[model samples]
Target: MTELDLATKAPESDAQEDSSVDSPTQSSPIMGDHEHCVTDRPAPAGQGPTGEIIKLNDIDVYISKPADYPHAPTRLLLFLTGGTGIKSVNNQIQADKYAAEGFLVLMPDMFGGETAPGGKEAYVADNSVSLLEQVKLKAVEIAKSFLIDMWLARVTEAKIMPILHKVIEAAHEEYSDAIKHGEGIYAVGYCVGGRYVLLLAKGTQEGGNDEESGMMKAGPFIKAGALAHAASVTPDDFKNLQAPLSLVCVENDALFTDEVRKVGEDLMTQDNVEHEVQVYPGVPHGFAVAGQYQESNIMDAQVTAYEQMLRWLKDH
Candidate 1:
């Protein structure tokens, strides 16, 4: 089969809430590692919004419930955001798209309110600049993750695990009727968010081994997951898979590096993991979230990635 139709083994938005309940975001945990919700009854999807924030662990969780939800239990998915954190327009837009496709999409802010400064401006690629200049910018941003109190340090495993658990609990509580199929959840992540899904894909095994793949159980965590232009993750994160995975990557991402991307590919193709990896050759790291922009509109690369993401969600 083609790379797009791979049978290789591998592993692992937002809108607003219009509810009366006051809700809002932060959940972090370590990598085998760091840790990582949903709601309301909404009608069919639309261009406007198929999502809303509801209170889960006292934080606002952006969610979109498909009209035919719970029909396929795996339709429930947890959406982990990248350095952009949550509540951004890009995230909300993606969440709506997922919900529109019949998936129950949930996203909680992983960085609390301390998201990386600058939004899309900080990430837009400038074709005129030297590649070295672009690489330097990425290096500076990654280095900040190590210093105490930067975005990554603040959302360490210990800090975010509780909230991540509560997110699942909240999902169970919200979709009480369809409890049987609800446990086996799916997850999708963008950028650093993909790191979190791999951690969950690490499964419940303490040594982080998926020897029996028991962790892919009808889980309160995840049954399967997908990653798009992922960043800030390591080989230790993606090598072993407890479940199925769909990875959508880009050509020039420093964070998702050639080394790391190769490991993911080998795991799916060489190793025994069940996975699918798609690399968008000319796009930047955040293409899934409309990272490349034109005047007042996002470029078509975002659309292409969007179609890929939804297809992975459906097939997997």
Candidate 2:
């Protein structure tokens, strides 16, 4: 892990919360609404992408294709959202931008159309606490009660693997004539989504080597992956990863600290896995998807990180 050593500033305390903790639930039609599940036009700009919503194995996946798509995309991107789950405004913006650049982007609702009971308002209810305090509390609650105990339990490999298979099947069906035979399918994820990327790359639904046995596998389709400000990932998690990986770390991120970065790098190197770790200065966690509220430096960092991902995808 070579360090670039770019000048950095302390992260500012912006009012915004990481999407992983506090995002509004999207109003997209749920599964079984066959007619409304797929649409040609997306929601308003800044809200969602200008693409169609398709149901994959009963999951409502928002798919944004290039305007001239079916001409075959250079690559297919499975863009996973942060803790805020799918339908995060920032995630939508990122997906739309990538689609405009000719990549087919798919965003699945990680929460299966469910959201925090009170949504964004729940985070702000206790005015006695600072915004940061609220975010921290909400993050812990979601991680323990929802993410680990509920969501992941229901959306296991049995459910998710088929969705991945179906999405790829649909892509091939639509662009059969134009697809380049050896072109790749790539994945990029932020925060909790990043953790999922690693799981997919390793062909298992859960982390750790022992737990992977008999898990429904789905890694073969993914050629490469990039993780940005990932959470809950341990060095051991990378030992069995099959695809080349890129780690986009933020200098001031509380979750992805220097120690965690080193552990990941050391493990990847020892395992002889191809990997790259780049640290962006002056940014907080979730900068890749939600840096719009930060200063110019943070915004610039966000663009630079995104460009790095594009380059990595092209090179790999």
Candidate 3:
């Protein structure tokens, strides 16, 4: 794919409540210890969703249905994966956790179903290139390179939003029985995925050309949204949010810095959007989904953030 086509393929909350203080009702421990794995093992038949890879509008989507599918209705969660690319063990564990909690979770591969060459190891592989260089290279290939001027336009108009439209339509048709109770649609995104969450909430901005382009409007479908370790979000991005949002902020995230967090908060306040921004004291970005940090506090933060996301979805 060319850069533009690759770019096309690549690609919160309410309230003032402190989600950091929220604790999970049940313990959901992350898999493995420190090494992040790429291959995702299937969920045990009766424990969680029967995970499957299905085609949606020519795009491959990894779907995890609740074990008791169609027996009773449940909420639908579009679990967007982070910049590390989808098909990671970390994301699967988290999505299974959501499914275990009774959500029909749909995870789309934002990289047009492409897997990184060396899986999770490629990100941290021992090479002449430094780890930072590796990360930057991956980020560019996945998201950052396309997120320049008109970043929102490039993403919402070209990449994920169309895929989102197809997913929503397919869900209504395929899961009509399971979603009959009007449990409503909710979303959780990480890193670049988080950017997609915000775009859904805000819809098209003033000069976005969405009307002329006829892109799908997510504000009508999504009832609530949450995200962790979001990248490329700005104060101006919050202007047209139509639903409640929750933000799980990492205190030391280089991408979602304190300044950017403050701008988001300030903009939310000004816009009168129901939103929440909770700062986890010492963790770095991707702590929630990746579980890269093994410290007690960070692990606790992950559990708390997960609980908070569920709570927000239920509340809204």
Candidate 4:
């Protein structure tokens, strides 16, 4: 597997955490409601994003933070990439942008060792193999099909969440003061990763019932979320979501337009879930990547979508 030129070592301690909490808009008390837990605890680790790679769980992952992260207790903007491979530089640029906006950013390569186009397919195939392995360790009452689905969910979570938790925790360990006063952590996913935002909000998968073979206890990590250009998530899967979620889809994105609408509609109607769904006109599926469209109008549409998210975050 080819690795990007990310500096995988621990970050230099020069970037001091922001100590002030004097914003015009005070953060709402959301994170305080989360009951801190002591489950199977995973010790914290970090991977630097400056073209260095750090190996965690034997997989080389990259991370980065901004120079003037302001040491303020801050929120997080976690980006999950889609079908296309997650380019390290692209993620660093995005993370830098988020840090500039006062958010600690995290981007993980869930593609494992595969390349894009073919890389997404390879991820699913590898997941299938991992599912088989997990099935061998299942309880006798669990059917093979049920075990397979649970295992697949577990494989996905294992590939992504551990690293996510590690990244956030590492930031906290290095900048505890900033975190102690942080606003709240939020998540956003694009394409397949958009679906992942929902999955992460739903928490870890328990055994699925007879009708549904994969079940999850809602996780408290993400307080709010945004999903753009997403696909493959079903409405049944989202009934467990308790966070405020906003979904943005391009008019031309047939995947979200056709199939995902039902999921959005279902979410809108649910009680205790604050959500919004908007379709941008004339943009493509990956328009958020910035250079995907040459037309300024299309770019504007994507920017508008992003602005909506920022506004919602500030409001909610």
Q: In model 4, how large is the Cα lDDT of residue 67?
A: 57
lDDT of 4 at 266: 60
User: Over the stretch 1-316, how does candidate 2's per-residue lDDT look in tens digits?
Assistant: 6531111111111113433323233222111111111111222245644776677645678788778876554567888765454555556777887788777788877556753222233333234555566566655444434333343345343444455555556556654442343265678877656766766777443422322223234454577888776764555556577788887876755555566667667766776778888988766565666435437786787788888777776677
Model 4, span 89-133: residue lDDT tens: 444444455565666555656556442221111111122234443
The residue-by-residue lDDT of candidate 3 on 1-316, one tens digit each, is 0000001122111101111111232222121111111222222234433477787655677787778866767778888875444456567667888887888888877656543222222222234555555455454433422332233334443556666666767777777664565456788887667777777677453333343324444354576899876765665656677768888876655456666666666766777878877877776456667334336786688789889887887777
Candidates 1 and 4 compared by TM-score, better number: 1
- Candidate 4 TM-score versus the reference: 0.60
Root-mean-square deviation (CA) per prediction: 11.4, 9.8, 10.9, 18.1
Tens digits of per-residue lDDT for model 1, 43-70: 2244355478777756568888777666
Estimated TM-score for each candidate: 0.67, 0.69, 0.69, 0.60
Clashes found in each candidate (C-alpha, N, C closer than 3 A): 25, 3, 10, 18
Candidate 1 regions with alpha-carbon error over 4 angstroms: 1-50, 67-74, 119-149, 176-183, 205-220, 269-271, 290-292, 295-298
Go through the candidates in order and give each one's C-alpha lDDT: 0.55, 0.57, 0.58, 0.47
lDDT score, candidate 3, position 214: 49
Q: Give residue 259's lDDT in candidate 1 (0 to 100).
A: 69
lDDT (C-alpha) at residue 12 in model 2: 13
User: What C-alpha lDDT does candidate 4 achieve relative to the native structure?
Assistant: 0.47
